[model samples]
Target: MAESKTNAMRLLDKSQIPYETLNYDHEDGQIHGTAVAEKIGRPQESVFKTLVAHQSGQISQICVFVIPVAEELDLKKAAKAAGAKKIEMLPVKDLLKWTGYIRGGCSPVGMKKLYPTFIDASAEGLKIIAVSAGRIGTQMELNPQQLAEQVKAVFFPLTKEA
Candidate 1:
């Protein structure tokens, strides 16, 4: 398959950030984060999914989170990290309206706006991490710290305890 370029990929290129693109079969329509991680042969902990959430009662106030595909977001922890009283996952229907990306294709980079972003603290020690390349079937692997820096994200405990 020919390589496809996405806004996230383009942004990384413009910033001169080093990243490797990984593609997997999306034709089956199984585009879940965990599936993508497994298909790419990367450890679950090293592949993250981008989630969008909103401050309770304030649809306008949004934040982005990047957590391991195998884990679930802890709303309490995420709220604390985001300095929000309460946080709720943004409805899938509104994802594109806000982040310009749909479920399973959201990327932490190149959102419609630079909303507050927080990466799971677990990613801190990782040499590299993979995130969506702003489209289904594509992912970009790069240094975790560099990914956070590029998106102005902070490391925080945002996942539920297993």
Candidate 2:
């Protein structure tokens, strides 16, 4: 397992959050989110992708968004939910520095900073959702609500129809 995945597993255990780890052979340049779902035999809609965004303006606060792989993040909705006037996707370099995970491997659980987290409303009814366990080849399956509670995340309708 990769260091990032190991770190994530350690965090989840320490948090006492019930989760199951999955692994697969990661393909180069493939979208990790969809790849994870396919490997786990779950629908892509139940797999979430972690994205980093920043409030617009100089020295704006950074935010992390977790939404289903099949849906698109509505920045306007996310900004409104976050109480920020505007929002923009953070560059990969900054995302790595802030989250300590590179693009395609960013997980909301064990970030360098505890940014405000938002989960797409669609995840509410699901018993378990898949999220990157800080690596391309691994994923974590856990209760969506519990996951949100663990991160103090706020749920919002920030996703567009898949």
The local distance difference test score of each candidate is 0.94, 0.83
What tens-digit string does per-residue lDDT give for candidate 1 at 1-162? Answer: 767689998999999999999989999999988889889999999999999999999998999999999999999999999998999999999999999998999999999999999999999999999999999888999999989889999999989887
Clashing pairs in 1: none
Residue range 20-92, candidate 2, lDDT tens digits? 8777776666655666677778899889999889888833488878999877889999999889999999988
TM-score of each: 0.97, 0.91
Model 2 poorest ten-residue lDDT run: 1-10
What TM-score would candidate 2 get against the native?
0.91
Shift in Å, residue 137, candidate 2: 1.0
Pairs that collide, model 2: none
Worst 10 residues of 1 by lDDT: 1-10
Error of 2 at 130 (Å): 0.4
